[model samples]
Target: MLYLFGAIALFVIFDSVRGYLKTEDKRKYLVRLFLELTVVIGLLFLFGPLFVLSPLKIGYSTLKEGNITLYYPGGSIDMARDVMEQLKQAAEMNRQFYKANYPMPVVLAQSEFDMLRFGSYPYGGGTGSELSLNIRAGQMTTGKIAHEMSHRNLAMLTGKSMPAPNWFNEGLASYIGKMDEYKKPNELQVDLREGRYVRDILEMRGILGTPKWILKIRQGKGRVLYGQTYLMVKYLFDKYGQEKVYDFVVSLKTNDFEKAFWQSFGMSEEEFFQEFTSYIQNYRGEPS
Candidate 1:
């Protein structure tokens, strides 16, 4: 009905215009009216879907191949389905890896980035929410999908109650996304030796407080930070053991990072940071 109402209104306007134009020749007046109406109809057809002028429900837009449902005002159904399926698979894998039972439904939006940017967001992908992937970024890589899925799984495992620190959240996501493999130690070492580190993970912990900073890093220098965070999480798991890692994740859910860290590793944040930093420096060794 909204569309019907709009069509009716258009017709009324056109008829009023036709009446006012009192052309002496009936044939000429009819021809002019027909041309005007045709132009209006053509414009409506071109832009109607874009604006969702009609409140008609595009019921159950299902992508069977992807095994996902896409709720959108308008788009290519086939492409949306494909993206949804890939994201579902990625989310499932993350859920298994983290052992999160209550997996939240993923929401997809068409934006410049495939994944949702962090900050004060409410409805879809925002603070205190589970996984929300941007459809645009979904087209880029399955890795991006995995990264956001990690966020969702983490949120669910913790009952969406406890808030995780920046390092832990981004690090866990980057780790699950398998970004570490993309950053070989040899390459990183070479960069370090040449004093050309692209992004310092420790530095980003401070800089990533703002949305603009986060967006910049995610698009530009942030890739390097992701690699570093992945490495840090991996190192933590390898050094402290997966059981400890599991406990830390649990503590994160319970909002007891201090207790969790101390209980599992017998160290506070300062101690752990000092040790971990030393360990990284030692492993890398002085250049020359």
Candidate 2:
């Protein structure tokens, strides 16, 4: 589009110059040239950032460190190194817990939205494929790195085309990284007392299907949804154990939720949901 606009502008300018030199009336030609220039400038202003033509002096290097190769991209290299080290530790922890032999590389990018957008692509974060960790200068904490590494581990374990539901996936990631610990039950109780819990998941399920759901959840309304999901996954882990949950997650990699639920724990979805709801309502145990 920019190219076509540029060509048209050039032709208009050349014609206008010819009209100014050879014809009696150059005012109309000048007006046409000005309009063409305006259109060209508008196109450039609108499309310039979209093109990313700034050469993006981004550099990346792969280093084989222990069990994983860290793919580090430009922008705070020191922070990127720290994130990689943290991810390695987390990956090792997950490997020990799951006893899985497969280890894949971790690719750390420079943008959080870029990592999420990459994962948003069709099969972007697949098994034996790369997982992107967006590193911000002051924001890349150990907990955040662990959380992202957990995502990579889950992706590898699932080997599915699309990720599992955000509730399960994000809840588990949040749990692994200890982000859930920040949410005191009292805080949630306050929300519940204030009638802010949004009690029914069905009411907000449509928003869950949209891309903005993450932001919505981060904005606090997502709390009720994630809190419930966290409780549900914690219930599964508590009732069946982490190994069982791991088996269930691995099953989900190849099978649907219903099939995986039954195969992993010998219960149907309806039965599991019933038990899960019961556990959430009655389980008075401390948060894991």
Candidate 3:
């Protein structure tokens, strides 16, 4: 509807300009064009912040405590309070991991459509920025919030213009959130053995640049990519220690991620990938 309305507005402006160019009655055209423009502008103002107005339409209520602000549907105050608590806990966990604190906004969406209204991906949960999350209203959980909070914390710790590689970014989050234990080492070993996982680390750099990654998630093929990345990050933290990893992430604020990786880890990304890939391929454990 917004696109359609914008197209109509463009047509109106074009038609008005053409009429002004051709008109013998200049004063009449000027007056008519002014009115048309006024109407279009008025409608634009009315519709521009539709997402802001949606809360009122849905009888949503706001809750605030310290740095966390939550918007939830009316009659769900109890649930909203629970979400706020979860956010607080998630924030604390991230603060301990990152050694810093940041404020975040959370929206408890009654449905995926509600999540979309707030510019959040509606698949279970999503974040709009380093400091905002939209979660399916009733499905909020510790692991999910932790996952998103890790993303937010890392974003806060690093430069936005040049982000860390996709694999590192998501792998760190999944590792911190502890959400991929279900993926299982045996399953990853199968993917590795079958040549189904990411073959090159460069391919993992911007994996989310295409819609196919999300499609893979929906098709239940995400475990391979996510699981492999998680293990890779786990490998870094385990072998290099947390402080070194922290230094690398913090260096991103001043350096390109590749430069930071070299400075802190003492190796190129390819070197690390080769090391990690070999490690994971040889990792064997009883299936969980």
Candidate 4:
């Protein structure tokens, strides 16, 4: 839709310029050009930041360190430096943990409003190679940086077209980022006991990392989904070890995720899910 709108706007501008060059009526051409320009500006407002020209809407200072490049607005250079350092640490941690490296472009939004204007929220978002973070939202942490970088790293390693399951992606990222620690054990216990936790395997596998899922987090229902998946990945890590997990992620480059899982873990994903949920249910102690 953005592309189509852009093409139409360009055509309108081109045609208007041609008409102005040839036509004898300068007054009429000026009127038409004003209307056409208005339409183009209106289209930009309608499309918001998803339009290709969205990045140009803000003035960003660039900072580079290794494979990471930071873009931050004015008056936030200190925060940008902090973000760059954290991002560097996160990338190194991911490489050590997952044995994967990917170039990342990080955007530090000075406020929630800036974040929203950039097509993200206060928390932050990872769209494959790029990450947007709201540094002023009091949500910035090393774990959060690691979490988004994990997503980008996996996307690079696995290939975006056939990426792993959303639940796995989010869970592993949460585990790596330590975002799971935000949810208290007692709180998770209440969720599990009150039947508010993820139950169906299909539900777990289909859990998305989109904005709607973020809305669920805002509504207080997302903790279970995120918490459960984090525990799931943590469970595998505790039982199998990071080497097996790394192998599984690396195998995703060639094999389907389920196939890679079975080859790496000696159990089907369904079997693992059953075992994990049962472990959660039968354990006589605090979960995780």
Q: Which candidate should be chosen as best, given TM-score against the real structure?
A: 3
Weakest lDDT window of 10 consecutive positions for candidate 3: 46-55
Worst 10 residues of 2 by lDDT: 48-57
Top candidate when judged by lDDT against the true structure = 3
- How does candidate 2 score on lDDT? 0.55
Let me know the TM-score candidate 4 reaches against the reference structure. 0.72
Report backbone clashes per prediction: 2, 0, 0, 0
TM-score of each: 0.60, 0.60, 0.77, 0.72
Local accuracy by lDDT, each model: 0.54, 0.55, 0.70, 0.68
**Tens-digit per-residue lDDT, 25-121, candidate 2:** 6787678768887876554433321212222223555555676666555445676567667767666666654566346555454454544333322
Model 2 residue 274 CA deviation in Å? 4.8
Candidate 4 lDDT by residue in tens digits, 1-288:
233445776997788788889989899979978987787675554443443234453466778898876766766678777777788888777888777567776666556565655555545443323233234423567776787778777867776533577668878888888787645445655667888866653343322335446666677776687787788888899999988888888888889877888899999888998887677666667534
lDDT string for model 1 (1-288, tens) is 233345788987877577757667777777877898787655543333212222233322333333333344255676666766676666666765676534334334455231222112323232223433334423446666677667666767776522455566677776676656555555455545565453333333322343543665656655455555666677787787766787778776656666766777777766765665555545654422
Pairs clashing within candidate 4:
none
Q: Which scores better on lDDT, 3 or 4?
A: 3
The list of candidate 1 runs beyond 4 A from truth reads 1-69, 72-75, 113-128, 190-220, 284-288
Please write out the lDDT profile of model 3 over residues 1-288, one tens digit for every residue: 233445776997788789888999999889977887787555433322233333343466789898777877788889888888888887777776788766676667777776655556667565534535667866767766877777767776773622666678778877777766746667777787887777754554432432445566677767676787788888898899988888788888888878888898889999988887787688777775
- Residue 115 of model 1: what lDDT? 26
Off by over 4 Å in 3: 1-58, 204-212, 285-288
